[model samples]
Target: MSDSTKQVTEHEVINYLKEHPEFFINNPGLLQQLTIGNPQGDVVSLADRKMLQLQTKNQQLAKQMKQLIANAQRSEGLMDRLFQLLTDLSMNAPKGEFVSALVGFIQKDFASDYFKLYLGDIKLSDDEVCVHYHSAQLKTLFASFNNNDAPLAGRLPAVKLKALFGDESAAQSAIVLPIGAKAAHGLLAFGSKDDQKFHPDHASDVLQKLAQILAVFFDSQAVNDGQQSQS
Candidate 1:
């Protein structure tokens, strides 16, 4: 009848079992002291009692493995499309055709409902695609991004949505990938009518790589234009 010997806490018992996994095997008499209640309400062997815990642990590990595999597969698919996009952009063609092809390839491969490619001063044959903006205006609109070059996804305010899309833009959510404020002074936006299409967690490193490639194209085209003017 002492306070210290009243009872052992559940934490101590669990810790003891974890630290000494062979305790039950070493003392067979201890197994008779442990019992787990099942739906059938009958006693099970110690092995049967531990089976449920082991099965639960296995299921958790399996779930984690499945998630990892899914992520890897998604990344692989993006890389393949990116390679195709790069190959398309590398072909020898007129500047107008090059930009048009770049936009077309992205629209086809990325499954975007609506998209806007904003370049500083480029003129497109299609007036609908002539979504150009000054670098200062872009810096202001995307100031929320903290000047980082990563792609952003999720809902945008009505003003930012209108600025990126159009006045009658029907996009409920979108993904914005910054090309370069200094070099290209451009951005690529993918919009979707479905709010869940570009949910907050849809960030992809592939889009950042795509943005970098676009910056290179813009810089190279600038150089090409300069050469043509001199010749």
Candidate 2:
């Protein structure tokens, strides 16, 4: 027989197998010897190749599910901590002590390297709360917060951080949250030495809630002080 004739015969056999899907079922032993190259260019039996694909897919799915569970657990833990903080703040501690407690909780639980509370116009005797009267410096330093009432997370220019925190500030990443709007505007800044600790894409829901709770606390204190002064 000619080589061309042999090639045509081989092609005919392949075509016949392609047309008959049940050929493998009738000859199950042939599947053991049939080999295919995987993504790594390693030859493996047909069944082994299929099994490897399934294993890889399962590993990927497992990893994703594990990450989701870890995230959920972290969220739950944060909520619990927030509830505890709220409860602690509700005890009507002294003004200075209250500020201390707030900062203490953030530093101990939230793992923040630096925490500063900036009240735009509200006066607080507590050194923890830095009262900044509205000025061009304030506006320029927090340009990213202009007219925006949301939380911001990311790096800040060295000059801006120095202006807000201090010349000795060592934070590489930060979260800035606007407390009250309009006349009672204030800000809460949390910072960390780790650059990636706070990013624009980080979840802000919990941080926003924390800021709102603090705003209410500050506003309540202001009202109480006003009533006392009037009396």
The numbered model that scores best in TM-score is 1
Residue 17 lDDT (model 1): 91
Over the stretch 1-231, how does candidate 2's per-residue lDDT look in tens digits? 887676557789889989998999999999999998856788989999889889999999999899879777877888898788777666355655665676666666665777777655444664544445445676666666666777778887777667667788788888888776631456777788888988988767766776777677778777888999999
lDDT of 1 by residue, 41-124 (tens): 987877678887899999999998998798778778878877876775673456566677666667666777788877775665
Give the lDDT of residue 114 in candidate 1. Answer: 82
In model 1, what lDDT does residue 10 have? Answer: 97
Give the TM-scores of the predictions, in the order they appear. 0.61, 0.60
Clash count list over all predictions: 0, 0
Which RMSD values do the candidates have, in order? 5.6, 6.9
**Span of ten consecutive residues with least summed lDDT in model 2:** 126-135
